[model samples]
Target: MQDAPRTVTFGPKRFCFGRRTYVMGVLNVTRDSFSDGGRYLAFDRAVARAEEMVEEGADIIDVGAESARLEAEKLDPAAELERLLPVIEWIARHLEVAISVDTYKSVVAEAVLQAGAHIINDISGLHEDPEMAGVVARHGAGLVVMHLQGSARQPARQPRYDDVVAEVTAYLQASIQTARQAGVAPDRIMVDPGIGVGKLTEHNLALLRELPRLKALGHPILVGHSRTSVIGNLVDAPIGDRLEGTLGATAALVALGVDVVRVHDVRANVRAARVADAILRGWTPPWPWAFDAVTGEQRRPLRSLRELARQD
Candidate 1:
């Protein structure tokens, strides 16, 4: 396994991996996303949701103007920019958190990055647009090169892979090479296995089970498996009912050393990730609470003898 850099820069922010998993709240500003479409299509609602995610402890707000759902119509760059730029601009001006724009079009990426997006999450894995790498490199913005076997508009009906892990690793490696060739810094790149893009349920399960191999590529790993079909297929739950399953999968991902989890339900996932981080990354008391050794309990301070002794 290659030793990846501990920190990756996104705009003015730097994310330190292995300390605690970062949460990337998903903000799909489109009319046709698989889930939560049209909910925040309005400009006001979109900005409101972005603020809510930041307040809910999201380290990055990923704004996508187009849907990657299979059979979903492709959104042109003009229309996509119309939906995206305003939201990106609003978040950049108002929020202190990093912004990642989810797109594969170089035109859209160029505009959004110019408008203040920190990262370009190319769901196409840098395969569709030849100029995408150049645009991201020029801005020196962070990049997420996701692995999708086929086009997002019409993904393979039955995708096949002999060794899913090895193939994904190879694909991501090539994508990373593309980014490097285009002058995108190694420290500015992340990789996603593209959970629901063109993967089968079993394929998704295998990828999740063997994520350490992907981490071996030496880039921060970002997984957007929240409320996806894999969770639904496994738990037999629909889109709105997959929160518990999503949290369960998130806890597992944290244990496996994922650097960032792109999720829809930021508040619940943030709460779940804190517990997972406490257990896996070694708990640090960021709060003003004392552990009572005798009772084996945590409590707020109220003139405790130990506190007075420490003060002295």
Candidate 2:
């Protein structure tokens, strides 16, 4: 793994990467998001769902006011702010996890940050609003800069790239530079390769295969592969039925040392990530006690057969 800062502190929390993959539960409060949209549109329902996710092992709660799906109508800044403020306030006051406002508008970003959101997840990579980097900098919030080949408002055309990994890395590098120039701290920035944003299936697959290469950029890598079309297309499954595929992809990414996995099925993904992390990083049992087969007593620490034979 490339050498980078292992921890990112935002607001009152510190995210320790490398020990295990962090799960960022998706909380889209819009009625038109790709999945799980209207389910949490009401403020109370949103807060309740957020609490549910936190209990399910979500390290962060990403609240989105507007759906990022291309066909969804663009939300005005006021409407976006209005939609997000209540949920943001509730999560901020009640939840102990880090809160991220998924928005590209500088006004919404500023408003949510002041309302206790700790991060701004911009799909435009700080390019949509010229003042976005400034807003993030002013609030000293963590920033998730995702790479998209085209504008989020329009349908994404099938993008072509001579070298997809290299191109994505270059774009993120420039975006990070833009953020730094605008005064956002480097350690507080994360890069997402934009899994389903503008890329074709092959492009998304290639990015997944070459994900470890992104570590060269010296920032934490956040991959949002939860229930996206890539998985559905591969398995010929619908969005609502792609949880297994999502868990599969999430496990693969965790094995590759991804710092964070943005997901919808928080509890399932958390279990999957823990297993994958254990396999990749090695795990110790939480409790040492184990039943001894010979004695029928829970008096010995769990040990492999090889260790027992050696003791004999």
RMSD of each: 5.1, 6.2
Give the per-residue lDDT of model 2 (tens digit) for 1-312: 423337777665577676778889999989999987689888889888998887777888999988778788789999998889999888888877899889989999999999999999999898789999999998889999999888867637768899999999999998899999999998899999999888899999999999888988888999999989899998899999999999999989987889899999998998798778778876433544477769888786655422321221
Kindly provide the TM-score of model 2 when superposed on the true structure, using C-alpha atoms: 0.90
Instruction: List ranges where model 2 is wrong by over 4 Å.
Output: 2-5, 283-312
In Å, residue 304's CA in model 1 sits off its true spot by: 26
What TM-scores do the predictions have? 0.91, 0.90
Each candidate: what lDDT? Answer: 0.87, 0.86
Model 1 segments more than 4 A misplaced: 1-5, 283-285, 290-312
Residues 8-114 of candidate 1: C-alpha lDDT, one tens digit per residue:
66765667776778899999988888889889999999999998887777888999988888756688899999999999999999877889999989999999999
Q: Model 2, 214: alpha-carbon shift in Å? A: 0.8
Candidate 1, lDDT over the whole model: 0.87
**lDDT (Cα, 0-100) at 195 in candidate 1:** 94
C-alpha lDDT (0 to 100) for residue 242 of candidate 2? 98
